[model samples]
Target: MTALDNSPNKIPSVTLDDVDSSVYSLYEKREKIFTRSIEGFFQNVRLFTGWPLLLGYFLTPWIMIDGRQAILFDLAARKFHIFWLTFWPQDFGFLAWALMIAAFTLFFITTLLGRVWCGYTCPQTVWTAIFMWAEQVAEGERHQRINLQKAPWSLEKVFKRFTKHGMWMGFAALTGLTFVSYFYGVRALVTDVWHFKLADTALFWSVFFTIATYANAGWLREQVCLHMCPYARFQSAMLDEDTLVVSYDPQRGELRGPRKRNADPDTLGLGACIDCFLCVQVCPTGIDIRDGLQYECINCAICIDACDSIMAKMNYAPGLISYTTENKLAGRGRTWKRPKLVGYGLAVILMITLFSYSLFTRMPLELDIMRNRGELYHEVADGLIRNTYLVKIINMDRKTHTYQLALSGLPAPRMVPDARIVAPAGEVVELSIDVLVDPDKLIEVNTEIEFRVETDDSLWYATSESRYLGPEPIRSQNND
Candidate 1:
């Protein structure tokens, strides 16, 4: 509608007057949702379950184990330390197994309960719930919030918005700082934050996570689950007809109407539902359960709580909306004997077993042999074949270790700098050495040789296999 008129005379340029504006659009405006608060058994359950997760997230990094943070993923050092075990890049298999197990477990849960994790335990849901609670505290209840939203800018509206956003930002900052504490030590993080001494990487990530949390939990809210989350897209593949989801029993609730107290359904020709629209008001994603099963449903059951309360006040039976399977809603029986559930459970179990076995048997030492490829073999001063190898030793332990290298599968070989090599804890130490073997020991060229690196205390040993270059056997050449 407007453009810069930079010339001497004002003129209209780059006009879209000939195009129909309704035919195409790159942006869809979002409708603001003001979800009403409701209370029920599921609400209480979420409250109790969510607190532990929030507390654990905020508290775990502060715990000290063996003079170090209990749980830390030190990217700078390329180490991940759990409560009792430390993982290195070499132990990537364990991380793989853990991820597989988590995936299978999610599949199993989705097949049985249908997005219960999203409802009860997802970070997005939990944080959004808390943010909404803070909003309620600052701006009052549902109608009050709606009124304030439509109210013209005033001192009261500014005060309420400022208070609500202040709480949101405070919580988001704490969340970001807690995430950073999982990598940086908690005490150090606190001191650095207090003194403004945080490293650049830490500060950058802190600000990034702060903005991410604020945007996701405060502004985007349900849009993140409805549009952005990949899990919502694939959940239909994981669901089954027998999967229990928060559903409205249309058989019992349809032909819905409102009636006076002590009204008889038979005479009124109406179902139990009062058609109050409370379910819509209470829904976080703002979808009607009467619209049939939808991917937008997160199974939060807040609408169920609203319906049940309304039913109670009307002296009717509860469970007009409840966790029910499609099969059950269709007047069919639901069986627990599902092949998909069994398969997912089995996969999860198998992955867990493999992960446990690998974890318990993991070694904290690594040895790699890097041969000098510039020259294969050369004659030393005394008619000996000399092969140079760089042995890379990484000590993935908590303490220093003195390790010695030895050659095997080759007869009478001398290693230069035969003294034991010292490896500092959590550090990679490379030692360049030469292997000098008598020419008489060369049965064939490219003979297999094993380098064994063992600790002086006989506690740990690692072996790497490489080829030793030598002259071809004289007998082989004669036969050729």
Candidate 2:
């Protein structure tokens, strides 16, 4: 065999066209979506729901309850205040239970009604709706926005763009401030913002959330649901043929063609679809519902409203696009007794019950008793055995409590100082306790002891167990 030339200098130079260009490509360019404005039943429903949700989010932090913020997280102090209830780090189990209940509830709702949460109640959707409304106010309709985007930059365009972006930024900042107020008190946050005195950590979170809101709601609107949200990826597992979803009726809308408003669609071999493309225009995700269910579809039902309006004007029956089930569209009956749905419902109910029981049975006080480790035991005058303990009492109640401490599992134990201790509401108090026992009663190297704390009113009580250290018991010298 002839040896091939192996030297780099002997190789001919390669042209740019010789290389495959596709290998260099990293991502597809994003197309801006110009969502058209349309008003219908679903739009009205969204408006009604969105207003109340926004009001609750903005007003909740400012509301005062029992001389404190109604919903303060107080992370620095490891305390959470929800209206009248206070939660400490030890009560984190309740928070975990609440989260589990919320997850199961979402699963149950998805199994029954599809992505209603995504369409109406999701933070992304709600904020996007608000941002879109602001855009409409500043930039006219979808066609106008498209034309403006293509047109050369002018004074009017600059003004409109500036105004729209300013409004979006302001709203995003407000949202961020409100969110942070849940962890930091609203009044304090407001003062800090007004004076530009926000702490570094608070400022970082504020700016971080503000940028997130601005990007997700104003710019990344539909892309967030399509690409970022993990729920969109796994929602199919939670769905079944009987679940209600935004679906297009191909059986009724096929043979699609344009026709006169007064013409009979049957005579022209056309279905109810007028081919106006209004549904595609109004869709936030820029998807055609007639193409069938897609993961990108948020089940917002705007297509249903759009199709229904067109059908009314064309003198045709509505429901060419609607909230329906796959089974219903396939001419089959649907029942709610499907195993998956039942299982999800049961899980949700069980979690809710557990959360309720935990909340109701939560104690209003906590206690901890730690034996002093430095010295095991001390022998004072008259051969008395003395043990020192560090006692911690937490008052979870809303009122100050004067707790009376007592010892158990010992006979006539003498306690130094008064046993009465005072603890403020939602405060932890640590005390040094010394217990003196008669040497005659020393029978073991370590003795189990219980500490009890009772409120002055006797309405609340807490207890803790600890070991009392002592010298080894001495057998009678006569036996030795």
RMSD for all candidates, in order, please: 7.8, 9.1
Model 1 reaches what TM-score against the true structure?
0.90
lDDT of 1 by residue, 268-306 (tens): 889988777788878888788888899989999898898
Model 1 scores worst on lDDT over the 10 consecutive residues at: 1-10
Top candidate by TM-score = 2
Each candidate: what lDDT?
A: 0.88, 0.87
Q: Which lDDT value does model 2 have at 41?
A: 96
Off by over 4 Å in 1: 1-27, 374-383, 399-404, 421-424, 455-460, 471-480
- Span of 10 residues, lowest total lDDT, candidate 2: 1-10
The clash count for each model shown is 0, 0
